[model samples]
Target chain A: MMKQSNLLAIVTCALGLAALSPSAMAEQLLEQQCASCHALQAEDYASSTVQERAERKAPPLYYAGNKFRPEWLVQWLQKPERIRPAGYFPAAHTVPGPDGDVVDSDSLPEHISLSAADAELASAALMKLTPYTDKLDAVDYEVGNISWRMGNLNFGKFNGCDACHRDAPDYGGLSGPELYSAWDRLQPKFIASFITDPVAWDPHTLMPANDLNQAAVQKLSDYLKVNGEDE
Target chain B: MRYALVTLAVSALTAVSAHSWAADAEAGKQLYQIYCTQCHGINGDGKGINIPDMSVLPRDHTDTSEMSARSDEELIKAIKHGGKAVNKSVLMPAWDKNLSDEQVDDLVAYLRHICCDK
Candidate 1:
């Protein structure tokens, strides 16, 4: 009876050991693959010089927990796609042509991919990396609606956000990331607040702090969500 | 009489070219309203919606004193290539990948009409 009980205890311990926690796997994967290219600890690229930040291989993932949805992060890790067609500050990174024009020659390398299980682990791990948890928690997020025609007009005409950002692939500006999937990939609260005062989020970010009231910012967020739905 | 006829012919030819040039500028004006007016301002005054928030103010396109100093070649290159191509601000993204050569030239013409024309 004593031997059987000991054997059962050992089996339970072994099973627990074999099940490597998602946090452990995440830390390992992040250190092994992501940390090599990404500044996982900091979002101070905004403070760095233009030339300094432009050389980065990837955007900082320190704020990923606050910026991205867990589902989107998991799917993206499994099947990575190009987000920023132009690198961060494309002007500083790409070599210019003899005609003194910048061609879209330089772009970011392909994002790293992970297996389904690994992606899930990484996603869980990343979702827990919330340095801004207190601040983010304070935000009051609500699903809302905005006028479709007015939203389009604001993006292209009033705000000129489309000048640098794309609504979808093959449309809008080439500089910023595509916003068609923004609703899925990003938190709406982050989007509206970031644009309201960009410097509040990223001091050296090239995106001009747009002169938009609170209502406009919310409407813009709603527009992005609606636009993503259509696609 | 032959000299008078030659003068008339030259004037007509010049008028035809000028008319074509006007159409190009007109097309450029439409493009500007669509793409640039928001940043450069409706009257090309560089006081768009983002003006208050910008640290470095956008170039006032209507500033004849500055625009007159730059040649057409320089202006066209800046428009098509971006600011960093000419060692200017990196805030200006290149447009050549999206715009054709003719469209760039037209934008340059429109800039001239707005900023440099007496």
Candidate 2:
């Protein structure tokens, strides 16, 4: 009876340790590497001024779960790339050129790449971060198709989003982030929310709040989804 | 003394009317830096940082002749309503949702300062 009781005690202890290890280890990894630059906490975006936003070292990951798909986040952390070609704020990264101001890509820092194991752990932790849960819940998205011609007209001619964001690789404007892989990278609800009200996510975001209605925002999000799949 | 007082009153009235007519260019400048500079360029020269990838060039606010040709009403329409409203490229988004009517007037005043005031 005593032997059986000791065996049960050991099993309970092992299970307890197993449950604690992943979260504890993930926290250690995040604190050691990501704490210096990335904002892991929910920030008061409404109170942050333009100048303050411009000076942010890295994009906030407090809403990572809401913003990024788990697979994409894991992959991205493993093989880091420049998502915002001109850095977070294009204005701060520009220099004089013959024709006009040019984006100084060299001035931007390379995103620190993580090993596969570390990336998996980091993404697991990041995927649990849903500080903007209410914002995410507010947007409801269904997979829909936008025809190439109609999508082009809406994105370029009507809404003028192509003026800043890239709809495809080497296509559209350069000021905003490339949207060619948006479907693969971002959550649909997050995309819709951002398009509908950019200021709510980032108060000083250069992307103008065009005040598009729910249907309009969905249409635009559909346009992006179809565009992303093309590449 | 009566004649001097009449002249003084007339001068004061003229100053007040002129002041009321003028919009706040300084406030407009701040708004421009936030909303317009991404495509319009920092100096309003049409060659913004995004110019490399843009299909259509932005309007150069420094072009005095081009700006002078456009009336305040047309300019205001273009700013408040999108560029499509003025029969131009739709690349310019409408600011009606974001900016107030008074703010639009201030932006026009700032545009005038940049182009015509030298």
Candidate 3:
């Protein structure tokens, strides 16, 4: 009877340990694979200098939980694609052309793809890394459909986001990431929070904090959410 | 006595020019990169990355004839109050919140340097 109880206790402890291992293993995998290029810790990149910005291999993943949707992250990890066509730093990858500085697509490298199982683990771990708990909590998304005309006017004309970001394929600016997949890739709250105050998220980020009111922020968020849905 | 007066006038003029040169154009170049390059091109030739999408092209700072036509006050107003303030394209955003009066002056000086200094 004593032996049986001891065995049962050991089995229970083993099962608990097994349950915790997935997350622990995922973290270990990230440290080994991602830490070399991607910043896992919330280390601020002093990207004030052009050289420092150029040195960045990948976008910092410490804010992944705050930024990316879990489903998107999982899928993207398994089938990685170039979000920034010119790579992280456009200057390094661009060549002087007749028109202006044109991005050299040949210079860009393919992002590393992960296995299905690894992507699941990695994404799960990434989703748990919410350092900006307060910022995330404060996101009040005013959910609704924004008309194309109104959205375009606001994003392009008023806010000048089209100055850096693309709203559709081969359209808009090349300085920032293509926003066509913003709704699918990012959380609505994250999008709103980011637009409301870009400097709060990253001090040296190239994005300007337009000091927009809550209504304006919500409208912009909605615009981004529905940007490429029709296309 | 006349020679002394001429020398004093020249010295005063030199001081003013020197101050303007030192404080404005150089500072403006740095600020332009931070705030304007996305839509104003790295070379300030008006062919920014966003040019393809924009209905109205950003003004070429390197256009000597066009830039020389506009007064410093007009340029300052446009920079501070956006294009709509000057009856220009509304695409140009107002930099009133982002830039100070002094900074706008510096940007105008830099615009002059790029457009007219050739």
Each candidate structure's TM-score, on Cα atoms with residue i matched to residue i, is: 0.60, 0.79, 0.75
Residue A57 miss distance in model 2 (angstroms): 3.2
Writing each residue's lDDT as its tens digit, candidate 1 over A63-151 gives 77888989999899999987775555444333333322232544446677999988988888777777766555655556687677877
Tell the DockQ for candidate 2: 0.36
Q: How does residue A128 of candidate 2 score in lDDT? A: 87
lDDT of 2: 0.82
The Cα RMSD in angstroms, rounded to one decimal, for candidate 2 relative to the true structure is: 7.3
Give the clashing pairs for model 3. Answer: none
Q: In candidate 2, what are the lDDT values of residues B16-105, reduced to their tens digit?
A: 876754647877887787677778887888887777766678999999999999999999999988788898877887777566798789
User: What's the DockQ for every one of the candidates?
Assistant: 0.02, 0.36, 0.23
Of models 1 and 2, which has the larger TM-score?
A: 2
Give the residue spans of candidate 3 off by over 4 A: A1-21, A43-55, B1-35, B69-87, B94-110
Interface RMSD of each: 13.7, 2.3, 3.4
Docking class of 1: incorrect
Residue-wise C-alpha lDDT for candidate 3, range A1-231, written one tens digit per residue: 579989999999999768867778899889977888888886544434323444677788898998899999999999987788657766556555678656778988788789999999999999888998789789887678999889978988787777678888878888788898888898888888988777678654556565578999988888887775765
Ordered list by TM-score, greatest first: 2, 3, 1
- Better candidate number, 1 or 3, judged by DockQ: 3
Clashing residue pairs found in predicted model 1: none
